[model samples]
Target: MTKPSNFIWYELMTPDPDGAARFYGAVVGWTIPATRDPAAGDMDYRMIGRSDGGNAGGVLALNADMIAGGARPVWLGYLEVADVDAAVAAIAADGGAVQMPAFDLPVGRIAMVTDPQGAPFYIMAPVPPEGGGESDAFSVTEPQRVRWNELATSAPDAAIAFYKKHFGWGQDGEMPMGELGAYRFIQRGDVGLGAVMPLMDGYPAPVWSYYIGVYDIDRAHAAVRANGGTVTNEPMEIPGGEFAMNAIDPQGAPVGFVGPRTS
Candidate 1:
């Protein structure tokens, strides 16, 4: 079984899945392999594959009904849990809201939820793959994998508390941002997973943004712009000599990229 509190999956719910697949495939060198799952009925799901032949994440096309119901294109992260039902109960009791009730799928039992501050994520009890080894789609050291998860929330303190209660996350260290509050690094065990900070002005809502690893930040930035996406922030060096930047995909899904830049 996968360890609880680990980020097991990442997904892009986009209005144009094919376009997204192509855009990301160009930007990150990920391959979009089609998946036919009998459990999902007639829906189309495409698996994102990394260069090492491992599955990275997935792209699910948002249907008309979902769009009409106010669903927008966005990237969502899923944290692994031991029991979906119990986790859901704990979340509710801790002042969170359940967006989608727990349901079984071929991959796992999952429920969509938002913390008290309204930043959404998924809690899943995943089933092991046929041959059984862990998936490296969301890894800290793997190239082209998800490297970090950043949360922009109104209630940073409460959000941290809720995640600590449910996911066993602990504060590792923090960086001070003048006039913006501290950027609190979160860890699962000894591994630093991400950070939580105050939501910036003009943001539509509280949300989580993930950073994908890339070998060449310059090339990735060029690819993003060439594929109809816009890089909102130019690549800048972070503490570890790695470059990071924020961007919006062609479909307007916010994303970040981090790694060394050859140029």
Candidate 2:
């Protein structure tokens, strides 16, 4: 068992699932495979496959009702838990709010939740795959896998406290961001997951953004632009000499990428 507090899965909710599939497939080198799960019923759900031949996430088509209710395309992360109901209860007690009540699908029991600062994410207790094992979609060292999870929040300290209390996350380190406050690194045990930082003034609402690993930054950046996506920032070097860029997919979902730079 990998314990109750790790990020185990990710998903994208978009109005145009087909367009999103094509855009992300080229930008991140993922293979979008049509989902055949009987549990999916009549809804259109697709899987995001990594370059190394494992599932990275899923693309969920936004229903008419969801869009009418003001739902926009966004990438959401799912944190694994042993008890979904218990976790939701704890979140409510800690001033957090529920976006979707807990429900069961063939894969797991999941609840959509937001932190006290209003950053949205999912809490799930997944069923083991048919062969009975967990998937390695959250690896930090694997290429084309989700490498980092970042939370941009209005209240960093309070957000950190909520995650720490529910998910057992701890402060590994911090980087001062001038007057913007500190970027606090969060980790589970020794594995560095990602960081929590203050949301910039002009950015959208508080949200969790994930960074996926790629083989080459320059090439990936090119693909991003060619596929109708928007790179919001110039590729910048990070702590490990890897380069990263923030971008919005063709359907307007924000995401990040990290990898080697091609000179």
Candidate 3:
């Protein structure tokens, strides 16, 4: 049986690696180091460590070739599966495209792919350590960790069905959004992962916006402004009464934070 994916890891590909580190360090309290991953050979790949220890994900510096090829600052997530090659084949047969071919890594096999809607993400069959537990990259309330994964797609129904067929995700319930569309919530078994919202004028293309947990929503907003980032909107109340806001980093990567709003 293919183990249903739980977002295993997250990665940020940016042009300004140092600037991204500093910006996220201030806003999300991540302790990103200056060292690059030796396993990546010559590529500048740095692990994004959480303040409490362990990694939130990684940051990859965009090379000249990549930038020239139209790669932009974006955050991509890794979804774990039982067999990478099998998953890739299944995805391709279902109208998905392979952005990067599957390859073996110290962590496991990973492949970059786009959904039928063109939103890109990674699929991995992670090789866990001898006794390492499930990934801590996603958490609901832990500060500095990925708290929510929201996907804004042009075709919400098709996108939702595509994900459900490949990843074993289930659409549990939805919240009506007036004239726009309903915000559909998806869960992996009992764990409430996040929601899928319809793309609007503000978001023309399909993209996944990950919201990291913060100690205070207002403080996080201030940090973004102080670090040359732009907040898209004021902190708004979520379903749980917590405030959530979105922003674009210095390099124009959309990011989000969720927590209480302390004035």
Q: Which candidate tops lDDT? A: 3
What are the per-residue Cα lDDT tens digits for candidate 1 across 1-263? 23438888899888887788789888888987555434567876777778888878888888899889988889999998989999999899888999999999888899999999999999998898889876576777766799999999998998898888889888878999999999999998888898999999857789999999988999999999999999988999988888999999999899999988776
By TM-score, the candidates rank as 3, 1, 2
Better of 2 and 3 by lDDT: 3
User: Considering lDDT, which of the candidate structures 1 and 3 is the better prediction for this target?
Assistant: 3
The ten-residue window of minimal lDDT in model 3 covers 1-10
| Candidate 2, residue 233: lDDT | 85
How many pairs of residues collide in each model? 0, 0, 0
Q: Which stretches of model 1 miss by more than 4 angstroms? A: 1-4, 34-39
User: Each model's TM-score, in the order given?
Assistant: 0.95, 0.95, 0.97
Predictions in order: lDDT: 0.87, 0.86, 0.90
lDDT order, best first, reads: 3, 1, 2
* Candidate 3 C-alpha lDDT tens digits along 131-180: 97999999987888889999999889999999989999989999999999
User: How far in Å is the alpha carbon of 245 misplaced in model 3?
Assistant: 0.4
